[model samples]
Target: IEERAADASTPRAGPIPPSQRSDMVGSAEGVTEMAFDASVLRERDFRDTRRRIQLLARLPDIVAGSVDDEELLVRVSDTLLRATPSASAVAIVRANVPEPMGAGDEKPSNEHPSKMKVLHYDCRENGAQQHSVSSRLVTTALQRRESVLHLWETERNGGIEFTAAENVDWAFCVPLRSEACAGWAIYVAGSRALGSNWKELADDSATLADRLGDDVKFAEVVGSLISGIRQTSHFQQRHLAMRRFFAPVVLDALSGQDPQSWLQPRQCDLSVMFCDLRGFSRTSEMQSDQLLLLLEQVSAALGVMTRHILDTGGVIGDFHGDAAMGFWGWPIELQLSDPHSDLSASAHVVASVLAAARAAAGIRMDYAMGQTEFRCGIGIASGSAVAGRIGTVDQVKVTAFGPVVNLASRLEGLTKHFGVEVLMDHASASALQAWLGQDEFTEEPSPFRLRKLGRVRVAGMKIPVDVYQLVVPSGGTQDLTDSQIDAYEQGWDEFAKGDWDSAYQRLLELPAWDRPKDVLLRLILQHHRIAPSGWEGVLDFPK
Candidate 1:
């Protein structure tokens, strides 16, 4: 009786084809019910979905921290693959530029290798080929800016008819976009079992992409903030250095030293010089790889020159990229019995830097040869300027803020317009009159070109001030005597004419000990700005 009852209670239909299903026992009863509770199933599904979303959300932050493009792509692909288990592969393709208004845009990475592993295509070697599902998905996402899902029924033979029918059952493509940029495309693919969950996974993946996009935006903001902070800090530091040089007593107090030594500032005689490099931006553009390297070399040479200045009792106020500014006098002014002796020192500094520039240019030739060259124009002005610590304890800055410093900078700028290498104002020329002695100097008429100083007006002062150029002869051993130096200057002229070979040849003739060699090397290396072989001798270029 029990066996008969059991047989009657059991459903008659087993797992069978849909066409063969029995109608008598009712269709619903034919299939076995899932043992799990609906609530538990729902909770598990929600948790899984959240986990997937959370993983995708963190991807952009991770990618942004990557040092280079290759790492960025790899990180993106890995994150997407982990999110969707059915995904056999994932890929991201980026567009070079945004689509124009009312026009169809083409994918920049359409030729990239697919990320799929099942397809026996060597993507790493041959790049993203047609047989790769990952490649197609990346391309599609980049073009559509939307998610595309393809299943086995829709895409067979790895999306190629001639290839063997390899099963890539499902694929999901999602576009990643950042402000003003189309970042990449994320793609995932897997087998039929994975294909069953394709729609749901696609929804989850798209959500993840949105989250990652937000992270990218945040990273950019943070990066910009950091850069701004760095610039501000650098400016403040320069101000502090100037203060320390001019007013030791004030600097001591700011650093928590004795306040008793504070005394009223007095007018002091000083020599101010401004050195500016020409064509720095153009040089940077021409030698993109070696730009940083060149900057470092120039900075190092400047560092050496600065040391020379300090040794000679000169106070360096500020050093900006391709610019060095300093003065003598104030805090403690140089006392010269001859009075004309300061002129020799000023000339020495200019000559030393010129030598350093030549050496730098030579070093660059060893790396990239005659690609680029550098030239610097210097202006010197000697007069009285107030020097003191000009800020509160927390924000104190030592600076020589007066008309003399401004005049020096103006003279430096005027050098280019006048076709002169070194220019000096009337006061500096008079101060160095004894040293000039009709041998190493030339006096040119002041071409009074009026200059606008923003809003302030100087009564009777013209834009271009009276300036004199130094005309040192060739083979002079005092400081500016070297064939290599001449070669450096000639090379710069050739470079300006787009005669790279001639420039390189002239630069190559410069001796190893030449100062301009260093400057020329930096200019040439700017073409292929590779990372320095080691961290030694690196210096920051002025902006």
Candidate 2:
């Protein structure tokens, strides 16, 4: 066995072989001629070059809004091959990994196959590699980033080697990054048997790669833009919700309602109250930051009061900076069996509102100016009035438009004239008399004065309206009356008739003592029905 092995390794010397000499000479001449031809060929085929450019230019427009990655790859590969006829096969690897060398161990050749082969290699994993061979001349072009060209020759060992093996011949690998999570690598292989110049073909392949990359970049930008748009939409939605929570009245105006019809022509019984902070303007002017702090405290106090009012079934009409207006009977009504019952409810509402305002004022004074104290004046009235959406479409407001609202404001102003924290008109005072508990008022009552105008008439009266200043603590009052309860039920009936204007007017007229405002909202809601299209439902007013 040792002797045999030695003989196998030993070189065998023989006589001059004519056949081998002829073959060697012929191959050398052929290679030299081929090299000359390759050198003379230009960088790229002019016709094919133009076609590829045109195809690449269209890629961006085609790929937009497309979700199918495979379809995108296939279309891109087809465009590339058509643009450059020398390309024997195009393989697109849509993954981060290196591409596999062959299709299932099938050895690739430098000769062009009978048909062009296009393969889609899906490499979902991180490391996937792919390899393909086209014409030998083009193979040498696969070096650096873009293009390569090559020439193949068979050796005595029955193995094949490429010309200019030092540099990769005939290969183009272009990396692609998209908006999606994965990246792609496009591979184009040239054939040596086709007898084409690989250098020119390689350059063309490089150009193709660049064009495809641009397409990928465009797609990525589009995806990012879409994401940004969605984020903006979400932010807008949240903003609207916050606005609605803070200002329900403002929101209602924007929600589409006819201002003139809703506000101008309707009558209902209602309880109205006006509250204003004392010395707020002067304090705010002195220190703006301090004022803001004061405002925040005031807002918190108002929030608590508003919640209380809502819990007791009252509707807040409007708030103007430091001032706020609330109503009981306009939008809803209460059922009051007795006149005294009506008076009791009004007393409670007025007391509750004034107490809340004072609490808020005190808090603001304590936090903003330790020694400084704050106070608020409130006025209460019960009467018939109209309230609804008012103003032009571009600038609309939900407002109570009636003498009752004016009277309430006038009474609030009278708080300064009368030198008292709270004052109620004779109507409201009478309605709330029972609910005032043990609190008393001075018998020598001054006339209720009006702002701009001097005096005004009130409901259920034959003489001038007499106003009373309640001598109650910051926060004390009685429950509602039976007549006020009757008023709430009547107000609700009007609200259900799709007559918000009349409902509000009649509800306001019911008596402050009725606690008409506290129970009015609930009654209105109970009796009122909203149509599917959001219109107010018809009311069956009881006779």
For lDDT, the strongest prediction is 1
Full-model lDDT, candidate 2: 0.44
- Worst lDDT run of 10 residues, candidate 2, spans 1-10
Q: Write the per-residue lDDT of candidate 1 for residues 48-101, one digit (tens) a residue.
A: 456645764675476566564465455545554455454454544443323421
Among the numbered candidates, top TM-score falls to: 2
lDDT of each: 0.45, 0.44
lDDT of 1 at 345: 40
Residues 376-403 of candidate 2 have per-residue lDDT tens digits of 6677777777765556768855556677
Superposition TM-score, candidate 1 onto the true structure: 0.33
